[model samples]
Target: MKNQAYRMALLYDFYGDMLTDRQKEFYDLYYNEDLSLAEIAENYGITRQGVRDVIVRAEAVLTELEDKTGIIRRFHKMQEQFAQIADALDGICQLNEDRYQDDALEGLCAQIRSVLSDLKQE
Candidate 1:
């Protein structure tokens, strides 16, 4: 709705498999081809309001799926956490060369991997 590329991509990936055929057609034209609602309506032989309704409904479906299946959301959170851990590990490698920190990093990486696996499971 707000036209952020990353958010749009997440919504598309999460609900891409769940859309109806007509919804998919409208979505592809609007999202993938960057078509305006008026253009989509004209190409699909529908009114602009009809195109708007289709897109709104599709977005609702995607939001509902994301709410129900938090794999995508959790995966995003995990990615951020992983990035932080990687940065910390790099700093540790440079600043603290010791067995204790190495063990801690190993444990942290294991936990991160477990979180990634949980997200992947869904």
Candidate 2:
């Protein structure tokens, strides 16, 4: 999945708990299929502008849900921090002829486990 789309899908999974039928269909088509508004409009037999409006409203609802609940934001922040730490650990793993490299890698690996555990608890 595209990165933005993946984030949007997570947002949907969180916010979709509250969408109306038409709103859910619109969001699923636009984000999941990579479809253009015009294409979705054609499929639904609505005007392009009408499709655009519906999509915009749905996006707003999703955003509102995320902002209110903050689950998606927390998930994104955790992923980013985890990636950075993983990259740092990879750099440490590359160090040669150094005892500290082993220590660093072990510490980072443990930190990664901690992060995963915390997320699971959440």
Candidate 3:
């Protein structure tokens, strides 16, 4: 359940600008602010059912955008590839330390690690 919410938030982050102003507002209030339908409706001077309708519309928009673009899917794939690359680099670094003790190889590994760290941060 928690993971599903996180995924929705990530999708929103990617394609939220595509939503209408009211859709964005209602979606943010419901998901980010943890507001109930009644509370959001009260604040917006609408019925709870109206608020639910807006939120549902917003979700459909977000999911549709993700389906068309698949940017989120590509991002997760890249993250997994990066982790594999980092693990391989760690093995190479350890081998250098134990067997080769080569300064040049150590420096190169450090550079690769730095680049990986920067990419992961983004």
Measured by TM-score, the strongest candidate is 3
TM-scores of the candidates in the order shown: 0.69, 0.59, 0.94
TM-score of 3: 0.94
Between 2 and 3, whose lDDT is larger?
3
RMSD of 1: 4.7
Question: Candidate 3: deviation at residue 53, Å?
Answer: 1.2
State residue 90's C-alpha deviation in candidate 3, in Å. Answer: 0.5
By lDDT, rank the candidates, best first: 3, 2, 1
**Candidate 1 C-alpha error for residue 20, in Å:** 1.2
Alpha carbon lDDT of each predicted model: 0.78, 0.79, 0.94
Per-residue alpha-carbon lDDT of model 3 for 1-122, expressed as tens digits? 89989988998999999889999999999999999999999998999999999889989988998899899999999999999999999999999999999999999999999999999999
The top-ranked prediction according to lDDT is: 3
Screening candidate 2 with a backbone cut-off below 3 angstroms (N, C-alpha, C), the clashing residue pairs are: none
The order by descending TM-score is 3, 1, 2
Model 2's alpha-carbon lDDT is 0.79
The residue-level lDDT of candidate 1 at 121 comes to 62
